[model samples]
Target: MTVPDYPRPPFKPQQQSFPGKTDKMDPRPDHGEDSYVGHGLLAGKKALITGGDSGIGAAVAIAFAREGADVAIVHLPTEEKDAQRILELVKKAGVDGVALACDISDPELAAKTVESVAERFGRIDVLVNNAAYQKYYESMEEITLEEWTKHFNTNVHAPFNLVRLALPHMQEGASVINTASVQSKKPSPNILPYAATKGAIANMTVGLAGLLAEKKIRVNAVLPGPIWTPFIPAGMAPEEVETFGEQTPFKRPGQPVELASAYVMLAADTSSYTSGALLTVSGGAATL
Candidate 1:
């Protein structure tokens, strides 16, 4: 079946009470299941992606696998089914795929996840620190201190732990790609904490790029506008979900596969000079 292009909302009103389980999605978000074609851009590479069971991480896993890379994804234990599906897709590409289950917010578990992957693969070529936690709040009173701290722990601290643990396994020519958001520049009132972490990720990408340049490791970020993923309907209201991407100039949200090429470029050898860059994959969402 041909997936329709953007500008039209293509899904029904469906929601998952919790994150993970891509199969529960209404339209079953397209992870280039039949469309994305690879060209050996990342051959012989080993990649570790947090939250790789679904959404953008799943899309990247499939793309990297097709391009000839062995993939190790970290996801919550509840996401085993979704991780199984991604593993199947990676295997189809004739590459190895391993899925590790753990809550990345735990610094010790996060470090161990990276170590396991590095041990299995011998080294890490790509590290995508994409796992995040988000919740909608109407007012400052509605947001608890624990909630705020949890967001930082999962969204910010987990990335830091993973990077530190993986750095020793990363050599020259390695790439670290972070998933930032259009919210990084333009904050959405409802999801303040999530947006704040995205801003931090973008800033860290630039600073880390310079820090890692001496080691010849590239650090970059992808600033996505609004993509049609479980994150949307799961986080927003039913009415908001119905009109999800209407605010964008494209009048629709981007698909997971649409952002695949940007990730591929950053992870590939061709983007060796593309460190510290913020590649916006927003469908006409304005970014400064």
Candidate 2:
């Protein structure tokens, strides 16, 4: 996969409401529908992924299933259509696939969703806290207290709660992967709240890795740079979307499929020695 093969900047301007749909994307974000081939690295493992309806989470779900893991994906009720499509793809990989409509910002609801996945899978071998919420703001004054709280609730508190709830079902060798971002380190002021949550996520990942080391369960995070996903169109202005990833060294936004291998590696037993690591999959952009 070369830079030219992927969609580049100056793309056709487009926009969508929060949590956009895949079908509406101009180039249609690829979730490794055809490119990814698994090696049974995670055979018989059971995995749960938040926000598995689309974008990076969706790609990871597909990769996990193809690698022979039973997958349970959690999404919002409004994202059921997208969730169904991903579920079908997962099932096609010859593994058990389940989808739960959940608003994980609610701690109680998140706990219940984790319980259902644990019960269905018999145990949770891998937990991917990949769901997130963000909105564009021109200034701190534009950010309401309610919106600020929502960011933490969805991005920070929810992941923490899921980890807490799933811990009982996880055993030694299980993996926890959080979706931090380039913003965690190199934040943009426009989305300060979201950036702050990501910074917290990165910090939490390192702390959790240390805490879980005694339990032998690894904790890590993936820090993705600019990527062509529903989030771009949904969270930014149409003009900004047009030039989406132009600043990257590759001069193009990464496809969701581009991040699948990193998630697979983290979840695989081969990475047993890897923990508390923040793996960055940016298009040659500096996270520090």
lDDT of candidate 2 over 54-139, digit per residue (tens): 99999999999999999999999999999999999999999999999999998888889999999988999999999999899977
Superposed by TM-score, candidate 2 places the C-alpha of residue 273 at a distance from the truth, in angstroms, of: 0.9
Cα error of candidate 1 at position 170, Å: 0.6
Q: Considering every candidate listed, which one attains the maximal TM-score?
A: 2
Give the per-residue lDDT of model 1 (tens digit) for 1-288: 465754467457766665735777666688887888899999999999888888999899999999999999899998898888888999899998899998999978887888899999999999998888877777888888898898899888888778888999999999999998998999888889989999999999999999999999999999998887778877776777777888888888888989888999999999889999998998888877
Model 2 CA deviation exceeding 4 Å by range: 1-4
Q: How accurate is candidate 2 locally (lDDT)?
A: 0.94
Model 2 is weakest, by summed lDDT over 10 consecutive residues, at 1-10
TM-score of every model? 0.96, 0.98
